[model samples]
Target chain A: MDTEPALFSILRQGQVLVASVHTALDDSQLLRLQRDLVGRVGTDRARGIIIDVAALDVLDSFGSKTLRDIAEIARLRGALTVIVGIQPDVAQAMVELGIGTGAVATALDLEEGMAHLAAALGPAWTP
Target chain B: MPGLTYDAGVGAAVVDSGADGPPEPSAAELHLLVTRVVRARVGNHPAAEDLVQETVARVLAASDRIDGGIEAYAVTTARNVIATMWRDEARFQRYQPRMVDLDEPDAPDMGVLAGEDQVAVRRALESLSVQERSLLLAHEVDGTSLATLAAREGTTAGALGAQLRRLRARMRAEYLIVASHREPPTERCRPVLVAVALRDQRRWREAGVDDHLAGCDFCADVAGPLLESSQQDSGRVAIDVAKDHDVVEARVAVRRLAADLGFDRSDVTLVATVVSEIARNIVKFAERGRMTFEPARSRPGIRIVARDRGPGIEDVELAMRDGYTTYGGLGLGLPGARRIMDEFDIESVPGRGTTITMTRYRKDTR
Candidate 1:
């Protein structure tokens, strides 16, 4: 109802489609965005989803677990998810909360994350 | 927002008596708002109620500003009142009595005082050297610090300081190592001991001992007990392993005792492995066995003595050999246990029983 509480933008690097999430992406919003990205890419070609959480000040257990779940689901859908901008305190809190972030590939910033995703997806993965 | 009533009798009071002004929040609304405010402030219900009542009284005095959103206004007012109450409570606690005399001579307070005395003794001994410990004992206990220590040890102020520093560092290190092994120390102790040991170790080797002693408090607390236990004779543990369950229990018990002795997890694992093999042998060959966990006198290690009343092995030399086993597998238990442990001894009679005594020194001790 509130436009799903987050902003989503799609960018293209010569047919390589990258869905960039630029707001506080919670569980439901993440799921919705994933579905929308999968629909846009049509599953025939590989796609990359880059979740930018730079604006987030707090990352509780539910948020971290949801991100992990999103990564797993994206892999199953033949799309790779790169989570970026995890702050040090948020990482520490996640460890203290016993939230396992082992599944997802994390990067310092969105640019690096995109680079990593691009490298993992290879040159032919471009749409 | 305009249907409000003013009660001039209750010290400049304002009440939202207007029919449209949210119907003047009911008793239930007031109770819920106050309860939330109190819980957030004091963390206890009864104390929260007292603070809430005070806030309500304050609100009643200045109720003239009662507007449309009365619930939000009441919550803000309650928060301010609780904040003021907390400050006053903290101020009162600051000047509270440190000691209370309850007229009884021998009570729990005396035990508290004894605890305080122990702390004081530890604090005093914390900065003394082994020489200083001996010196203090000689001076205070034997009344010989003035001229006798000076004559016997050639005591000068500078020499005394150096000796005291060394002594203090050793005791501190030993205390710290023992403390660190049990549980991580508090934030305050960790930094202080770290600074002291780091600075002291730069000058002396004994001072460096503090860094190694940084973990287990159980070992630190029982250092004296361990020494006393080692000094005493005729204190041997007798183990009887007559059943399979006994073997398992003995292995678990030895592992636990190793932990109680403040052995690190790796050492505990090794000892547990050796004890398991020995225990299994007793069950398979001897039918029954017993094991004892004792402190070794000559060495800084734990001695595990296991015995079984079964058909004893005919060849002691063959059993000690690395690949010699009648019960299959790699047959590395006896030899492996011997190699891993510091000392190992096995004694078996042809048809009576066998006793194997093994000792594993603590890591720091080794």
Candidate 2:
């Protein structure tokens, strides 16, 4: 009788898609995110993806790796991707575990991440 | 002693208390009950039986104040005593390095400098310059700070770090080359070889050793023990968890154990990561805990037990939820650990503590 809530909520701002993740995703959720992103990017033709992860309490190795892969795949599709809002404890654990989010651009929060995208994309960019 | 073993009869008789004006449970009854509780909580621990004995003594000492039934009182007392034991063990494990089973051929054999290995190391070290050899020995064997050594040598810490990193890599490479060929290295090379051998044992940190080894194929060939030639069973590894470093140590021990049990590279990493998550929780929440790795009794697998006396989980079902965190922590730890491991069990009592048991079977081996 009850259905699970969506794991991520996407809002398109001009040429960018700001996907705010609301839960810790498992393998199936990750696949869903990937599929949704592909469908959205195909229709909207977004040039930038900002993944907001402020609600995420933990980013285990698998989750971290998946995010990085998502960023890589987005780049291949001509979209710049940035991750924002890593909690302090999660960051500490990731460093100690030697689980680096390799080559993934990161920002302190959604605002800063948008700033980064706007600056990188130049004056023609709109958020 | 023979009569005391009849705890079941005593318990049964006590059930009909109204018929005899509620006779109190005897010391033997309390002892048996407390022993069962302690043993169930601290399975396979050498101190479990001793802890039960101590609990019974403590309960009897305060027998007068027990308002509730003696069985309930004894169980509560036993739980408190176990918490204190876990706290003490955590403090002790923090100061002491864990003992690992490196004697097995498949163990993480940090090459010992003995016999032919010693001879090769000696020859290798002698090849290095006097200054280089002393620096290696002072840092690796003597346990001197690189900063102090650098001050004496008139170099900055950054420069010294770089120099030592390069020096260690070169020495290890030379030692491995000489060691593989069965040739006694020149005198200039002896001390360097000994330094490499010592670093291999993890007696002290060798700057950039892992990085250098990763890039160098020759050193990789000769660096690790030729354990593939000798098949041996891995004995039990016990890691005391008190801090983040201890968590890392526990993970390394698990990885080695998985390797010893012939798990593939990715499986080894998965097992190690699971250990890391569980051990981290122990340190983060409990400030101390213990992890033990041994052969599972029911199957061909490595069984791991993680026990902590931190504030217990109030809602295990909710905690099992992936994003649930009562302390604003990454809720991913418990759920993530469960996903990685083949088997996971968690037990927690509010105001008491928590224990997690997990096992990863060598399915291929079985």
Candidate 3:
């Protein structure tokens, strides 16, 4: 078995939240994490979620699609989604794969991603 | 004397005013003129407004310098200003979006299934005797043909075939029983492990496996998820060789992957030959370019994407033609790459970039 580390950390400030995914988040892991987060924060309270993946070196079609699905699920649960730390090569690969990054708000880095998430959550909720 | 002096000064100041005051530019005429200037300066309208404003400002400032018709002067000034703006803006925009930091999100790990479900699959497999496991593993994972397996095990093909049939029946019965009581095994749950096993065994040849899979729906179902999982996990491997063309290194890597995938030696040779040609091109023309290997989405094939940001091919169609080379010696870079692979795609934007994708399918080992 491939023993690659798959870790995720969740940070919450009031209603706003940020999830730092620090591994190769495969399809299976993403679904589990999404389910767990939805359960813990109560679909309504999970206002904003930011996936920080600065460490990942690869992002394939399955990976890109999972991000879109996460965004859709988060939206349904009254939360906004933003993805940060997408490497340029991976972005190019995603483009070549013809996968759309439209559903998830993508940022150059985590700080910008957090800012986008905060803004999406509105002025009332500061993070 | 005072009246004559005043008349002389007035006559000196009277410049030849020529034609009736420059034809008044109508609003439509002004808009059309501005639009043309804007388009010329900025390729698109999104940035045209700013260019138009700058043009108007320049025209107003140089009003005194205008010798001829005001409209002509305005148009001339607009074009000059637009040209200057385009040059400056192009440079600025180029500097703003650096190549670094366009990071995308990591692949999400969708919760495939619980650990218990995986345990259930293993337990079900283990329920069979060691011989049964070995037979199934050889047939399903290694993708060894019944004839080959029979030969290896010193048995007849008919006996080996019956063995596979019995093993499949046993596995299906066990899986059904597990599914009835336990969490339904996800499509991904069992196949992922099986794929891992196959990859580990280096049995990627689809030929022997393909034959068995053709008639066996159960085995296909079992292998499908594992194959997908393996592809997802393999990701992409990129090699950057500075000055030397690492043909040997690339060939070795390709061979290793091909061996694991169970590709026929001949097919591997064809792919390796194409890769060598592509590598030569990079060395000869590009000087430096990265060669990448990744799993293809369709079938048990691998994709090789070669990319270079060098002086692109002058004519892609001509370049694809066999023996069409600017710098001699059996020019088969494009055509050869096309001939060996199941699918070949090439995209090149002159002076910008070139990307070539080649896919080689694994021989089904049934």
Candidate 4:
């Protein structure tokens, strides 16, 4: 049994919702997080979603797919999702594996991810 | 009824399991017990240890009954377990005639209604048809030969023999369900437990077993510790790949190992990515497999081996081409691993499994 600590914490920053992932999550947990983030997008009227993956050590196909799904689903709910903080090695490996960030934007860290979110949210947003 | 009675068979199982199991069977005492009862009956079948562990699990499950003393009850349970294996082999596999029918003199109806949890056994018996129950009793208890029973029923002995074997198999299957103390949520639970008992991960994954095992607590309790054993050597590390988390763990561990072997930071990621891809392939296609890293036998390098008994590739050539996706993967797993590693070799049989061996040597610095 893994620790009962939350897999990822979702923070509401003005019109943006930022999900800071604390650790690597399994397939089912990733799906749950995806659903939760998508649900919160509509409920909170979030304009953008920033999923921070800096703490994750490995980004496999399933992990990449989950990020893509989260971004795509959040987009359908009228929010943009930016995955941030994929490590250099993991990114290189992802490139080797031919896994591109499919339409979902990426940035170096949480700050950059927040910037992407802010840009998507645009002029009137103050955060 | 009011006083305490000793059941040594149950005690033997607990004592035999030993020191949280040091990855080896305890001593020759129980080994010889299993050999004498199981080996002597089946003549050194490969699954002898399985029969022994199965009997142990049954003893733990049936902990209550005050059967024959210590050795006496164990001997009976061992025989029953062997009988189940023997009949299973005879029925499902190609029928090989062992000398039991012709040579043995009036065999001791091995575990029909004897040496099992009586309550569970009776409930299993209740699930059988009246005719089947009567046939079981007449043949097992009364020592009535199948020929005589066939004559009485006006059917050929061969047909009745098939029926009797099917009936017994059904009874054993039902008894296992009853003895385990809970109904399995899915039918795959039996094969999954059999895989756990045999520690065969390939069979464990063929029937949505990973999901089933993850969800079923009772089945997990029965099999968790047994299936978790792995060999650890100072020269190498062996990791069992079953899921996403295992792949991550393999990557992290292999990265450290490669770094320790003087691989540069970039190569460290390469080795880790190779571990990542191969282990992930196992989780996706094989459902379960093993990834092992050993010190190179004949070179100044490291040896990485990933083996899985899953549906192997039909055309290795086509699979090696770039951007060829199968099994919902990104399709670069095999090709990408081949590109980054110094030596890559993949051997696979269509229905059997796949074995990929990759070796990376530290660059010579003059």
Candidate 5:
């Protein structure tokens, strides 16, 4: 309830949709984003999804679960999901979560996330 | 013991003379009220009847002998009688002669003294062996007959009396040691002090202490309120966990605190993640709880404590094992926490609450 809806802005760039999370989201807001992102990956024919979490101070269990769920659902729609900008500490914490990012692709930042997305799209893919 | 003396005629005067002296309750009502008050205090005490009679006698006698009217005077007399009864009952139980100070042996009252004597006495008592403690207390404090105790133990009275005398001597030596506040004479005290300085009580026995810290000032100090102030460098941070956003806040705060406490970048994240998972668990399962972390005293690390009054886990050991998630699939919060923390402890009472205490030491790096 404390989180504003869609506080993180999403933008389209070619076949990749980049969603930069700028603030914290409560449970329902996170659920809403998961639904919206997975829907767009199909309807918009997006080949990849890049999620930048540089501004997020935490990626808690629920947050991590949402990321995993988004990735899983987006993959079913023929889109690849790449999480980016996980801080050094956040990365260490995710390792301790014992799931190792739950099979979701990760990158150091937005550039790396875009690079990973392009590479996962295969040899013929362009930026 | 009051200064006023009762005239035996005052008992006769109190009969039904409602004609005078502040007729608010009338003589019969006043008499009934006084009797009821006395009965409430000394309830079924065999001396209750005599106490009531004496109270009435004092009230009426005070009227002529003292300043106040009988109505107002009667209340004081009744209250004093109740207080005196309790005091006498207490005194009767002890059955000891009046106290005398060591310095002024002639004086009856011991007067007010400091807690040093009490602390010393407690420490000395603590120093005694279990058998000596019970035996000494049985004879001296509990008033159990020493001869009867000797008979029960199949020992002679003279032997028991001699053992009791040695027990007192050992207690006196311990009292002197405690009173002086000097370093304990034994070689073992150093390692115990060193372990305590490390701000970890778990290492107490491991630090070369097989025995003999009983009644030592250091032992009492360890058992005192010393654990709380251990983390004095960065102090402590406490946050309430109630919602998803609160977990985020807790993570950020814990991250900062870990950094402040000299945790490396990766370790900071580990601590922060620990906070995040635990706080989220509080929001998701417990509904509400509190999380606290602090510098490990002046040590190079932090300590964390999370407490929740909720539906506690029925099986704590099962909860700690891998693959035990209240939520289905890939839940590793608690188990992962146990893995990363240097020290982890969890106490839970089913249907009551849960408290998890954990600590992580920092690794030194440039």
Candidate 6:
């Protein structure tokens, strides 16, 4: 049997919501992630959302599209979304595959992404 | 579009020569005839019904009395319309000659089910015991490592490997028996495994195993998927990149194609990125071009070819450099694309055109 990790883990950094995805997900998991994030955004009252994909090894077309869609959905709920921690190989692959992550803002790492989110959320957010 | 194969003049001569010509077909009859004509040529394409409606409109517009039968007249008009559409489409083609070889090797028969054969495999798999099914699924679909499985089963890795081999042979034997409905000699059962393992290997040809597979129903049933799967593995998608929006269409097609070919998420994104880069180049440097996505013949990967008949590259080496760009790009398009794919090649002739071919293989599949 293929052992699957938890689809994603959510951390609350003040008003910011950081989702650290650790597994390469199939369609069902992506849908679950979308639904979970949307629901969490409502209850958590997050002003900003940072998706950390540092542990992810790949980001196929479907995965890329799902991320884009997740960002769009979060934006609709009035939270700024930033995708951080794209590996070098993953970034190169993304460029070669012609899948532009144009919809979501991307950062090099979690810290940079959180900084961007902190700036966007304003003086209330220090971390 | 190589879609239309109908011989437009099939029944026209008979209608023209028949004395007093056949009775004029009614509007409803004409609609049916034109629909059949278009469908026969183009199958159930989205444009088929529209072509039939246009044919009906044309028939309505004809003021002069028809000499031949209405069926023949409508058929001729439909053919003319289809031909004109093809001609117009041909004019928009920007790729010179359209296709460049990506090294097509004789595909091996690996007992992988494809198309209708998949149904047979599915039924055969259902007949397997739960444990046997799980073993196969864990190894093949789930991609569980042999070492890990061996550790879990409390057996040496070598023993597990041998056990798996035996299980595969038995499973394939049962699959063959179930699929072909033939009871072969007991000796023939083990040969099925040998036949499957060598299906893609060149040695199978020298050993006369392919010929054996051709004659043996059991072997053929087990190997049918290999034949069709390899065929499906190779395909080309040509996208016309004349406008910025067309790039999206091209990207969508590439992404779908990559996904269908069973590329992992990272690889799919890589394919999409390469396709987009080439397509964006078409929009930028050439103003128009074609991007083709095909399978790499020698390995488990996709081959992408981007060709344009615009002003060719002046410096090949400069274009490949990380920050080099003729059209003020970020200078990373070609280099980034090259870095992502497993193999990359480019050819260009000044004033003629350019062709960039790249391939990305699945590492885990290898």
Kindly list the per-residue Cα lDDT of model 3 for residues B1-366, writing each as its tens digit.
001011222222223343565444433354467668677656685768776766655654554566546567767777877778668878988987784687765545433455556766887899889988988998899898898988889999999887676566556546544654644244433333332334532433333332233223354455544445455566644444234326445655665676667766556555655665676676667665667676667788788877776677889999988657777434556776776577899888787657787888786821
Poorest 10 consecutive residues by lDDT, candidate 3 chain A:
A90-99
Span of 10 residues, lowest total lDDT, candidate 6 chain B: B1-10
DockQ score of each predicted structure, in the order shown: 0.01, 0.02, 0.01, 0.21, 0.33, 0.09
lDDT of each: 0.61, 0.69, 0.62, 0.72, 0.71, 0.69
lDDT score, candidate 4, position B223: 51
Q: Highest DockQ: give the candidate number.
A: 5
Q: Write the per-residue lDDT of candidate 4 for residues A1-127, one digit (tens) a residue.
A: 3345568999998888989888766665677788789889989998888888877766766678778878888787788888888888778767766667788898888898888777767786678
> Ten consecutive residues with minimal summed lDDT in candidate 2 chain B?
B225-234
Where model 4 places Cα greater than 4 Å from the true spot, the runs are A1-5, B1-233, B298-300, B363-366
> Model 4: how far is B54 from its true place, Å?
71
**Listing every candidate in turn, what is its Cα RMSD in Å to the true structure after a full C-alpha superposition?**
25.5, 30.1, 33.6, 28.5, 20.4, 29.5
Give lDDT tens digits, candidate 6, residues B1-366: 011112234422111223354455545556778889999987887888888878877865662455445567789999998887777667767554556666776456534445437765776678668877787788878999989888887888888777676566556545655566556644754455444543334444354443344234455556555444433433655565667656667767777878877887766766666676677777777776767666678877787877776688899888888767665445667887877778889888887677888888876765
Model 3 CA deviation exceeding 4 Å by range = A1-6, B1-366
- When summed lDDT is taken over every stretch of 10 residues in candidate 3 chain B, the lowest stretch is B1-10
Candidate 1 structure quality by residue, lDDT tens digits, B1-366: 443343434433344366543467544456567678778767875677777767666655555566456677778988888778778878878856645675667876889877766665675575566666777667556766455566677667567655555555455544654443444344434333433443432432343222222222333343333223432442433345555445546655676677777887656656765676677687778765556677677755788877665678899888878767785534656776777678888888887777787898998998
Candidates sorted on lDDT, descending: 4, 5, 2, 6, 3, 1
What interface RMSD does each of the candidate structures achieve?
19.6, 12.2, 15.2, 2.5, 2.4, 8.7
Question: Candidate 5, residues A55-102: lDDT per residue as tens digits?
Answer: 766565667888999999998888899998888777767766664667
True contacts kept of each: 0.00, 0.00, 0.00, 0.31, 0.54, 0.20
Docking class of 2: incorrect
lDDT of 1 by residue, A69-112 (tens): 66787678677778888766556534433344667888898789
Better of 1 and 2 by lDDT: 2
| Cα lDDT tens digits for candidate 2, B162-268 | 77776776666565767787443234233333344443424212432332332233433564442112113336665667765576678777777778777765566
Cα-based lDDT at residue A35, candidate 5? 78
Residue B59 of model 2 has an lDDT of 71
Superior by TM-score: candidate 1 or candidate 2: 2
